[model samples]
Target: MDYLLAILIIVYVALMILVGYIAWKHTSNSEDYLVAGRQSNSYIMALSYGATFISTAAIVGFGGLAGTNGLGILWLVFLNIAVGIFIAFVIFGKPTRKMGQYLNALTFPEFLSKRFNSKFIQYFSGLLIFLTMPIYAASVLIGAARFVETTINIDFNLAILILAIIIGFYVIFGGIKGVMYTDALQGTIMFLGMLILLISIYSMLGGVTHAHELLSSMAPLFPESAKVTGATGWTTFPTTGSPFWWNLVSSIILGVGIGAIAQPQLAVRFMTVKSNKELNRAVLVGGIFIFVTTFTAYVVGALSNVYFYQTTGQIAIQAAGGNVDKIIPTFINSAMPKWFTYIFLLTLLSAAMSTISTQFHVQGSSIAHDVYCAIKNRSSLRITRIGILIAIIIAVVLAYILPGNIVATGTSIFFGICAVAFLPVYLCALFWKRTTKLGAIAGIVSGTVSSLFCLLFTYKKVAAGLGICKFLTGKAVLFSGMPWPYVDPMVIALPIAFIFTIGVSLLTKNSKEEEIAIEKMFKAEEGA
Candidate 1:
């Protein structure tokens, strides 16, 4: 059985390699490589964006998180549809695509600098993308590798290296078009796999009502060993201050929910589609994809806890003993038929790699288009390829060195940073004329720095409070509470970024040239 699954995995990898090779033929010029010649249709954009957006985080990480949290995790799907697809495209899509067309911006940093006419904004934004995106890429590695390790009982590090090489090869060779095309294929596999898993698990449990009742009655009524904590059985909502509730509302739901709009990898999807009309088309497809994908995964994950607790009398705990990242992988490997587990594992890898490929591509573009271009004083394709190579190398090293649980912790940090760092400046550039170069710079710096500060300080506070924080200051003694004071870093970072953009814009008037540039790009009426 295990051999069958392993063989299926090998086949999936080969198919992906073939896809990458096919995409290779499309990449003669930098424009083709970077933005797909600005010609991706809405169908590709929808599936590709959904694939990149949904990753191991959605399936493994969020699934595990949802297992413990109950149906409350469905809130994220609401946001993905409402904020990520609907509001994002309606509000930000037209302008973002318009700007991308007007300025011929390939990357998010390029969009910022070109709009505001600030070389500094471009350089710093590029630097942030290069520096910060690796954490996200590493998280994808950890999440996908965890699925492999848990499913097949392979060594985690070996799985990480294997998965990294497979994903990195396609991305390094295939670039943007390869990534998006594979992302669409990956999206289909993930959607179908999760859906099938959901049906199978439900059938095994004897139906929805039976499963719900079983899950509900298991926790408190069961033995002490089975006494539900985290995601043992999501029969009911958390008993106040439960890690389940806080994590669902704050970390999973709020963090990824709002974080979607400003994501560099996802943002560039708008540029791929040709017009505002194409973007509108993406909304329906993208919304349905996100809803079904997230709903199936969350339902299966939360209910899998029901299956596990019923069978084993305890939640499937991570051997390293952390949160629920290990839950869905364990559920699949242990509960499902071996053949299905193998099929699902490929789907899981596809989910992670599709997103990982996009992150590397975006990071590469940020370096190639924004930072290296500014530094070298020319947009050289050779320089871009060099930047892409450097980005890949960094990702490879970080994927190897980054500690395991960093996926949940590290990914949150990256999303929070992008939200704080880019969203405000983007809003300002699109809407406000008074946004001077200095104001744009200040907003970005403030948001990026403050977001990092909040994360660092909060992590320290939590570690110290847990009595585990060590090295250097050793957990600020004053933080007596268990988690210290870690809120979503976005809460702090986002406000500071906004203030800098709006406050500074109000204080510092834009030059006539800057104003003219903004108006011409926006094609706005005087009041608008």
Candidate 2:
């Protein structure tokens, strides 16, 4: 079986290499490397967007959370479709595409910088993404590596290095074109693998009705530690305003769900398409893809509790030995047939690779295009590839150092920070013609500072984990209370960001030159 699995993996890697080689052959200039030459069809655009949006973070990280936290996490699925896909496409996507084209922006930082006419905005945002995005990338790497370690009986460190090197090859050589082409293939595999897993889980437990009933009836078995944190059951919501509820609603659901709109990696996909028509056509595909994948992962995760309890007289968390990051992987390996394990491994590999490839690409562009080129007033595809290599190394190192059960927490931390730091500025750029460069700068600064302060000083999970608050204040968290520790940083910081952006814009004014550029951007929107 190990030999057979090795052959399957080799075939998969070969296919990815073939695709990457084709993309590298087609890629000639910065335009092709950065935005896939802005000629993507709706199918490719949607798949790339969806695949980049959902990753090991969704399948393994959040899926494991669903096992530990119960079905309450399902709210994220609704928000992912409604906000991440629908609102993002219908409201934000068209304008972003149009403005990006008008500005000739190849990257998200470039898009903002060109819109506001600020080199500071470009380089600062780029620097921030370059430095901070590795945490999210590392979390995705950890998710895939954990699965590989478990399924193949390989050393965990080796799995991380292997996945990183393979993904880095295509991202560095083929760029955005390579990333998207492979994304389409991986997204298809994820959708089908998840569909099969969903069907199999249900059928094994006597179909959906019986499976759900069994899970609901086992509410009494909810872990004591989880109950203390306010988890109610496998099929019901947590106690409102409890720590569990706050984590679920604020960090897990709202963090990734609403934060998806402003992600540098995902936002760049809007510019990959030629027109709003492709964005429009992609809405349904993106929506369905998110729904099927997320819904399956969450449901299977919750149902795994039932499976474990029946088989080993243990709840999901206990069955997986208390690591929330391992529940999904553990459940699959323990409950499924060997043949299916190979397929699911491929599914997870596709998920992790698709997301990490886009992340490395975005990080590389942040360095070479937004920071370096903005400073030097010159472009270099060579520098971009070098930047990608650096990004991969940073992510792999973090993957090694970070503790276990960090997948969901790390994902939310990055997503929440992105929301606070970028969402307000991104919205103002897209919608508010009156937004000024000073306002944009102020917004970014305030949001970033406030979020980091909260994470290091007030958010218990992060502050305690980092030991920063303890070292500085002699407390686990600044506020040793119920809601403050539980509430996500985005809850406090995002509103501050929006207020600063709007208030500062009202006080400040754009220069005539900047005004002319803004007018042209709006005109582009009007034409679209």
- Highest lDDT model number: 2
Candidate 1 total steric clashes? 2
Candidate 2 RMSD to the correct structure: 1.0
Clashing pairs in 2: none
Looking at model 2, report the run of 10 residues with the lowest lDDT sum.
Answer: 516-525
Off by over 4 Å in 1: 1-7, 219-246, 318-323, 459-474, 477-484, 524-528
Instruction: State the lDDT of candidate 2 residue by residue for 113-144, as single tens digits.
Output: 88898999899999999988999999999999
TM-score of 2: 0.99
Off by over 4 Å in 2: none
Q: Write the per-residue lDDT of candidate 1 for residues 1-528, one digit (tens) a residue.
A: 356775787788888898888888888876777788888888889999998988887888777766656667787889888988998888888778877777888788888888888889888989899999988887878888888777777888888778767877777787788898888888888888877887898899999999888777756643333233343445555444544445556666777888888998888888777777888898898888888888888888778767766777665453214456787887887788877887798788888988888887888878887887778877766677667778767876787787544666667667778889988888777777667888898999999888776555554423443343344456543343543353566876788899988888778877888777776766742222
